[model samples]
Target: MNRRTVVVGTLVVAGAVLAGGAYLYNANQAEQAVAIANENAAVLIRPNSPIIGPEDARVTIVEFLDPACEACRAFYPVVKSILEESPEDVRLVVRYAPFHDGSEEAVGILEAARAQGLYVPVMEAIFAAQPQWAAHGSPNMDLAWSAAEEVGLDVERARIDMRSPAMVALLNQDLADIEQLQIGQTPTFFINGQPLTEYNFERLDEQVHEALGN
Candidate 1:
């Protein structure tokens, strides 16, 4: 069986044998972990990172996401739902965590779509089509591109932009910070800089509400 069908390596699939218990195990042991040290807080958000929602939002969710990770795909709508309910109060800052095969290509498509102000639509499309392209052990990138195109992405333009130095550098920066922040998992979340203590929809929603003092 493909390891990523349930979970992808964050820290290897060995930890994933039991219904992604490793993620819960790690998150539960962090002693209510802060996502990053205050001194290193600046690393969490960079100007180049993709942002969704108002720039002046009161709460920021920094998510370390791998596009090819099934878990990330599963959580996308939940995150979106929270954002929709509180659009002006929360913003999502996406950080790259390309832990699966062909994820960079997927990220490249996303970054390029961002340039055209099509980030969310393209991303939704990509995630909707993820099963076709992100099938573990037998990935097919063409399906991803097709989905992006269906969302009105200018494929040719995206193709050129994906290889640009700026995109490459941005990706590299995100990866560097991932290591610096000790992020070892896909879909790892930090709300207002405090890492999520556990991987569950209820906890995730609670954290966001708590951040808003709701």
Candidate 2:
């Protein structure tokens, strides 16, 4: 199997393994866990988060995503589809969960890309070439930089900005949120301060609809 695939499978699949325990605990605990999780989710959507779609949309999908996770790359289009389908009603707020090695660096590049007004384009480029740079323990930073460069990002400027105090602080804050929210994996999502309570595309779609009161 491909190393990158293995890496993503390891993290996400392991997370799935824990879901059984979560379910067992939830059965014994009633809605208490979800209530606490919803409270935690409320603290996740920072104003400075990278957002797509209408800022004042009725529904918000806050995703704690890691740049190097293949699952995150896969769900990118699904989230985009949700946005495209309901441009007026929904927005996506991306929170960094840079769990994998080099994932933080990737996020740094994305923050730099955001500064240069290339956030969406660079995100597209990175996910498009995710397997190339996001390999298991050995991320190819060169390819990641090249992806940003391909999108007209000023690479040298980005490199400098990546290490800036603002960017460093941004990463730190998101990481802190991850810990506080008890997020154990990447690509975790909350819709309108409501945890999905289940993991699947159908569940995501349902949650979004529920948030919209539809």
Candidate 3:
């Protein structure tokens, strides 16, 4: 081939290689984006006590909640109703991430309940009676204790468990995980390994159907 023809061929080949490289780079970035999203969306399950839900559910809803947050309290019933209504269709994972002043104690209470295999019941009671305990002023250990007692948790054992080093470490680890995930608010949810911008029954229902391919 002539020199000009050879030069033209070389330029075309170089352009093709560059375009291929860019395409590969973009594809790799997309893959990484998905991986990061999935990681952020994953719940750090506590050891020993597993969350309750169907393993093969179409959607997994992971909630990072604060026991002392009023909004979380309000959202609790909504979530509970959804789970109750469609126990088989959706899996719910609850993670404690206390951000308020009394939140530490609340988390400790939850950990204590988990130790006694009464986490779900105690949590349900706490959320149900949130109006009675959660206040704007100071932490109310007495009210929390009352709620625990009402839920049939061994109050003495729960108090002792609340002071355990293991419980403290668990809360600390959860807080660290929350920070790592950059979670900024209570009641944050992840749907099918994707962080949701907003959470509502309608949205959750829609996402569940999408995930299930229904």
Specify the highest-lDDT model's number: 1
- 1-214 per-residue lDDT for model 1 (tens digits): 2222322323132333225532464643575356254546889899989999999999999899988988787777668877888899999999999988999999999999999999999999988899899988778999999999999999999999999999999999999998888778788888998888678656777789999998
lDDT scores in order? 0.83, 0.80, 0.67
State in Å the error of residue 129, model 2: 0.6
Name the candidate, 1 or 2, with the larger TM-score value. 1
User: Using TM-score as the measure, which candidate wins?
Assistant: 1
Off by over 4 Å in 3: 1-36, 39-50
- Segments of candidate 2 deviating more than 4 angstroms: 1-33
lDDT digits (tens) for residues 1-214 of candidate 2: 4323444544464455344433323553426547767677656787678888888899989899988987677667667767877899999999999989889999999999999999999999998888899998999989999988998999999999999998888888898888888887767888887776666555677678778887
The order by descending lDDT is 1, 2, 3
Using TM-score as the measure, what is the rank order of every candidate, best first? 1, 2, 3
Q: What is the overall TM-score of model 1 with all chains considered together?
A: 0.87
Error of 3 at 78 (Å): 2.2
